[model samples]
Structure formats: structure tokens, C-alpha cells
Target: MGKLSFNRLKRYVNPEVFDFDTTEEIPPLEGIIGQDRAKKAMEFGIKIKQKGYNIFITGITGTGKTSFASSYIKKIARTEERPNDWVYVYNFEKPAQPIAIELPAGMGKQFKKDMEDFVEQLQRDIPKAFESDSYDMQKSEIIKKYQEKKSELMEELNTLAKSFGFVLKDTRTGIISIPVIEGRQISQEEFQQLDEETRKEIEKRAAEFEVKALQIWKEIQSIDKQARDEIKNLDNNIGLFAVGHLIEDLKGRYKVNESVLKYLESVKKDILENIGKRVNKLEEKVLEYFKRDIYLVDVEGERVGVVNGLAVINLGDYEFGKPSRITVTTYPGEEGVVNIERESKMSGRIHDKGVMILTGYLGSKFAKDFPLTLSARVVFEQSYEGVEGDSASSTELYALLSSLAEVSIKQGIAVTGSVNQFGEVQPVGGVTHKIEGFYKVCKEKGLTGEQGVIIPHQNVNNLVLTEEVIEAVKGGLFHIYSVKTIEEGIEILTGKSFEEIYDKVYRKLKYYYGLLSNKKEDKGDK
Candidate 1:
């Protein structure tokens, strides 16, 4: 059929090519969910910072150290309207070197201003107590005088009643009269001297006066009670206002002195000592440079010192120059060593020096490995210099693998997990931060449709993505994926499903073992 002119004919319609930029939409912070513990810690730290305490968050790299710190600071800055300042420092490469940071020295001044404002507001609300209102004071004075007068009148009335051989008893209806002498006889001369009509008129008038006096006394008592109650209430209100004023005044007049400074000094000393002990222990365990055998002692020279696990000779108490080398002989079973060198490099001195050391180490490693063909470098980012545990091994391994593969792992995708020697991925710390770090990065990068992070499946319980991230995820700007194994991680990174790639790896492992099994079987048969 004339060579079947297939070249001239189009085989079929052109295959459709789907273009999806995996890095296009950075995952919203919302999609980077999980990590309640880390979120809670961050929130607490923010609250503490607002109350005037500097915060330090410690965790392994890829566990969200920087992300949580940054997020918390951002939240506080956004929500709180205060004059307090916020400062963020990150990318420290050397933890052993001091980091110099400056804080506001005017915090006391600002506090005073705040107190003044508070006092002004209180004074306005309670002007009567703060101001010398003469009306109130006068009312109190008049009430006191009336009470004294009422007491005197009552005493006089009681004395008159006793002279008349009558006892007066107080009753709710008023004072009642009772005869002290029961059925007592009266002198005829005294009875005759008082005309019957005149006597009857006098008794009636006396009884009426008594009734009027009792009514007057009750009225006085009522007025006195009312005045006293009012005075008591006013005193309480004024006293409370005075207390508020006193607090404000004290706040304004507060001054830090030598004693306070000394106490602070002691506190600083304690903190430094504790921090130093921790550093020493960590150095002993993880600092490779400290283990070099650099100093040795010679018995012939009567030396009695050791350095870097070697006994050192005093050399007549000489101060050696830079790059000095020392040699020493070992005891019978020990190997002899020589030519241990020292460098004269001096580090910077500052408060919080450890951060510098950590930063320098990480920075140097990063610098050396940048454009790395087959290597990766990592550090405990934003840790403020502390001993992070071994939970970051798997993340480190993945970073190394990504570097080696020359694959650009999206910054939006942070990972946290541990890895065994066999390369099995394991769970890790601060799952929240790991998620949030990538989420923040994504947010900063402008959310695209494809942004997300891969984390350990076991860390699902730890997910506590912030509200912003959650909202963004709901809006479809971000996503989060959980993985259990290295294979799954590889699939996520490579954009290929594990179902498609796992069989090849499984076959390879099986084939290698099968060959060994066949060789053993043949040997047994022979």
C-alpha cells in the first residue's frame, strides 16, 4: 500500500498538556493545620510578652520555632494597641558568640505616662472624692452635731422621769410610763393643795407634753440614722477613690534604686549560671571541637594539667602564642599524640551570646553548602540557643535528600519527623510550628492554589492551624498533607502518587533478596 503514508497523516489529535505549577499558590496558613500544642504555646507566649516578659521558644528545626515566634509577634502587634515595642531576631548562625540587642530604655517613662492617664480617668469619674466638695463635708458636720444634741436631750428626759418616781421604757410606739411605787398612798395635804380641776388639767398637759417629746425624739433619731448612713456610704466611696489615687501616685513616683539593681544583678547571675551549666553539658555532648586532644603533661617535667583529654606540661608557666602546637607521650596502653594546634580567633562579646554561636555555625555551614550538588545543612532556627533534641533527624535527612536530588522543596512545605538509620520516617516535635512555618511562608509568598505542606501522619492530633490559615484554606488557597513513610514523602515532593512508584522500589528490594535466596538454595542443593 505504498509504504502506508503514515508520516503525512496526523496520528490522532494532539495530546492535551496540563500545566500546573505546584509552587503557584502558596498554601494559606489555614491549610497548614494541626499542632494545638504549639499554637497554645505561641498564644501563651504572646500573652506573657504583652505583660512585659521576653519569650524564648525552644524546639528542633522544622518544628516551627521561627514560624511560631513570628506568628505570635504578628498577632500581638495586630491585636494589641499598646506603646510597647516589638523586635524580632532570626537567622543567628553562631550560638557561642554573643548577640547584641537593644531594648527601649524608656519603658519606665511610658509606664508612668500610662499611669497618669489612668489616674486622670479615675479622677473624672469620682470627682466628689478627689475634689474638696464643701457641701458634703458640711452635711457630715451638721449630722454629727445633731446626734450629740439628741443624746443630751434624751439624758435630761430620763432624769426628769426618775425624779417623778416613774420609770420610762422604750417601745416601738414610743416611750411608755410605768409607776415605780405600786398602789402608793399620797399625802392629803399635797392632794388638797392641788385643786381637782387644776390637778386634772396639769396631768393632761404633762401627758400631752410627754407624747410630743417622744415624737420629737423619734424624729431626731431617724434624722440622725439617715445622716450617719449617708456619711458611712460617702466615706467608703471616698476611701476607695483615695486608694485608687494613691496607687496612681505610687506608680508615678516609683523609682528603681541600687537595691533593685543589685537584685536584678543577682537574678542575671543566676540565669547566666544556669544557662552556662546547660551550655557546658550540651557542649560536652555535641561539640566536636571540644573533644580534640590538644594538651598533654610530661611526668619528667613535673607537669600537672590536662586539656582536651590530654595531660599538659606547664612549660615553665609560659604563655604560648597563637597557633602553638603541643606534643605528649601516652601511657603504656594509650597511643601517643602530637601536633595539636590552637587558633587565636576571638569571638564577639554581647548579651545573649549563645545565639551568635548557633547562628554562625549554621550560617557557615549554609554558605559552604549553597548551590550544593548533593548536600544539605540545617539548624535549630530561632531557638535562642539551646539544646534541641534528636527529633529533627528525619527532616534533616529529607532536606539532604532534596538537596542531593536538586529538587526545590517549596518553602511553603515545612516537614518535621524523625528518621532511623534505615531511612524510615518517624514523628517529630512542634507539629504546629512545622505547619505554621510553611503556612507563613506561603502567606508571605501570596497564596496560590497549589501550596501545602507534608507532615507526619501521627502529628494529625497536633494540628492547630491559626484562624487566618484556616480561613485561607477554606478559601482554597492552601492545603496540608500527612505522610507516614519516606516513600510517601517522596511521592508528595515529586508530585507522583506512591501507588505508581512503590511497586518499582518493592520489586528492586525483592529481587535483591531473591537473588541471595537462590544462591543459598543452590549451595544447599549442592
Candidate 2:
């Protein structure tokens, strides 16, 4: 075939574009499925912070790191109690960190101060009540005068009773004694004994005095009631006014401590300075971490070397890159596989190395019963030196399964999706980059007709394949298959239809139209 000049080359037609209304609701961060491990990690970090430990979450963009972290933090903030509260700092990706401040559970300082003042006023007033010279003395004087007036009225009733001819009795019958005159003179001893009439006369006088005293007592009680009522009203008015003044005074006194203010000022300065220092330290740490032969692409999309002598990459523009050294540093060999029989538990180390490894080994018959052994070692093959993203989680699952099943996955086809223990395939992030990365490799290798990528069906909408990749696919040089479950993915990756591979389970992979499965189930039942 004759080579065509650049000027004579035919231009490709672009797809006709029209905007369509998308009423589809974007799922909340919690609704995201198949990221239980990542979500749990974020939750743990939040718990650590709640226990007063600062945390830093590291993950590639679109891995839901920020969303998960923020949501978890917000949950903690909503439930916990503290003197001061948490603040969310977003836009850390920008110059100014956008922040949301949350107040604590109880009343503010001003209100607390007012309460304290109210108690203090009560304490002071209670003591003054006992002190005779205090404001209560006015009420006491009124009481004393009422008592004196009542005594004088009782004295007048006694005089009136002497003039009356009857004596009053103390019993409820209200009986009175009347005088009786007897005409006999007796001896001194007999006279001393006195006549019944004289005695009766004296009893009658006593009864009259009791009646007069009772009437005067009733009158005194009426005056006393009026005086007591007036005093009570005065006391109430004073109390109300005092309480109001105390509240206002306490509020006025509730100034932020000057020393605390100064200390906070210093703290703010130190925090900013410390943040800067940490930024520098983090830069150095990241640089050192990646120093061992990694090929990182700079912000301009140019390949750059990472080594001890090279300047540290700026965090602002640094993207994911693969490690330069293709070293299988995790497990040495078959000896590296975990002994399941020896320990029924999976170590934290294994748990951190992606859930796929644990599931794959546990699921396989070869590794199932006898120490269900498996190595925690895994990495992206030929992924020389760039930051790895979660987009490769599915690939990790496939590789892990291949290891467990002793089945070699074709390196010609790349896979990208998350997987659960039930062997269900789930959606992942960066569908575009992952596909393009494989596409780049395939193009360099002279794409065989069989070469293709297996991606989750949910990610199909995100397929904005580059022109070159599209051309290759159309030309039958490459292909792409969308699978909803792990069974479908395996079929796609192995170039065997589900029916041909696992005939019995093939029906399970059939798509159910118009039915939505619970996404929570896909998130490891979290």
C-alpha cells in the first residue's frame, strides 16, 4: 500500500452532538458501591481524629477519598460533644482552604456566664436575707408593728371584760358564768372560803374578757394579712429585677480571656507555620518515597525521572505514576502464601493489600482447605513508574484470581473494575485513563485481533476513547467488552463466552432490564 501524505489524509467525522436533559440524580457519597475497604479506612481515620489524632488520607483523584473522608468526619461532628467543635477544610486544592465550622453541643460562653451570674446573685441574696440590716429589715419592721398593735387590742379587751357581769369559758361550748348574791355573813375562815355567787361573778368576768379578746384578735389578723401581702409583693418585684440585672451583668462580664486570646493568636500563627513546614516535609517524604526508580509524568504530561538527586515534584501538579523498578517485593515465592489452617485469621497486612487477593485465594479449591495459602504480593505488570490509581482494582482482582486458580490471564487484554467476595464485578474510577493506558501498550505491541479491555458495564457511559483507540477498535485491531459481573469479565478476558466457560452459572450473568439491585449489597453489606 502506498503511504498517503499528511495533506491527502482523510479527516474523520465527529459524532453529531445534542444536549439532553439529565434528570438522573447523582448518588450521595455513601451510596457509592464496592468501596467498603476504602470507606472503612476513611471511617477509621475519622475515629482516630475523634480520639484526638490528626489524620491524613492519601489516594488518587476520583477514588472518593475526599468524599468518604469528609462524609465520615461530618458524621462524627454531628454526634460528638466538645468544648470547641470540628471544622471541615475543603478547597485545600486551591489557594484558600474553604472551610465549614461547626459549633459544639451546649450553650455558648455568654449563656454559661449568665447562668453563673444568676447562681452567684442567689448566693449573695440568701445571706443578706439573714442579716437584719439588709433590705429584708423593712418587711421585719412591718411585722413587729403589727404584733404590737395586736397586743394593745388584747389589753383593751381585758379591761372591757372586767366591767361585764359574765365570765367566759375556754371550751368550744362558749358557756358563761353569771353572778349570784347571797345574804349571810360568815366567820373569817368561812368567808375566806367565799360564796359560790362571788366565785361565779369572777368566772363571768373571765368569760367576758375571752369574748372581747377573740374579737380583737380577728381584727388584728385582717391587718396582718394586708401587711404580709404587701411585703410579698415587694419581695417578688425585687427578685425579678435582681435576676434580670444579674443576667445582664453576667453577659457583660463574659469577655474572652485575654490570655487565651493571645495564646490562640500564637497558636494560629504556629499552625500556619507548622502547616508550611509539614508541606515541605511531606514534599520531601513523597519524593523520598518515590525515589527508587519511578517514572512520573510532570504536570505538562512529560515523563520525568524520580531519584535521590532530582528535585521533589510539586504536589499541585503531581499525578499518578508507576514505580520504575519492576520488583516483586511483596512475597518471595510459594513460601509467601498465608497459611490459612495454621491461622483462621487474615492478617492486617493481607487485608491492606486489596480485598481481591483475600477473596481469590479463599475461593479457590486449591487454596481453600489446607492453610488456604496465598501471597499478599501483587502489582501492576509493566506499569513502570507512575502513581497507581484505584482504577486498577479490578485488574488486581483478576490477577489475584489468576494466581489462585493457576490460570494465566492474557496480558494482551487489560481489566478495570472492583470486585466483591461474591465474585460480583463492580464499577471503578478513571475508566478513561485505564483503557488508554492499555491501549497505548497494545498499540506499541502491534495489537492482535484478540486484544481488548474488559470494563464494568456501569462505566460504559464514561468511555470517551481516544480517536486512535476508536479507530483501532473499528478496524478490528482492538475491542472492548462491558461486563456486569465477574463471570462476564472472566469470559471477556479469556475470550470465552460465559455459557461456554461456566454453563450452569452463565444464566446468572444475564442482564435484568428495569430492575435496580440494591447498591448497598455491592458495598460489602456496609
User: Which structure among the candidates has the greatest TM-score?
Assistant: 2
Q: Tell me the TM-score of model 2.
A: 0.29
Compared with the true structure, the alpha-carbon lDDT of candidate 1 equals 0.43
Off by over 4 Å in 1: 1-384, 496-526
Clashes of 1: 36
Instruction: For model 1, give the 10-residue run with minimal summed lDDT.
Output: 306-315
Winner by lDDT: 2
Q: Model 2 Cα displacement at 401 (Å)?
A: 2.9
Locate the minimum summed-lDDT window of 10 residues in model 2: 302-311
- For 1-526, candidate 1 gives per-residue lDDT tens digits of 5666776776664435535445465453521135677667667756664555766656556765676567657766877765533222221244465333233455555544654675575445444442344534554365545544554565566556655555444322335554443433233355467678855764665576576567666766676666555554454455454444544344344334333233333433333233212212212221122123222111111111110011111111111111111112221111111111101111111111222232233233332423211111233321211222234444444433343333433433444554444345545445554455445434543566676666667667767778987887788887777877766776655555645444442343344345656777999999
lDDT of 2 by residue, 386-500 (tens): 2222343455555444433334345455566655455565565556655665554445435677766677786788677789889989999888888877667765555455445
TM-score per candidate:
0.26, 0.29
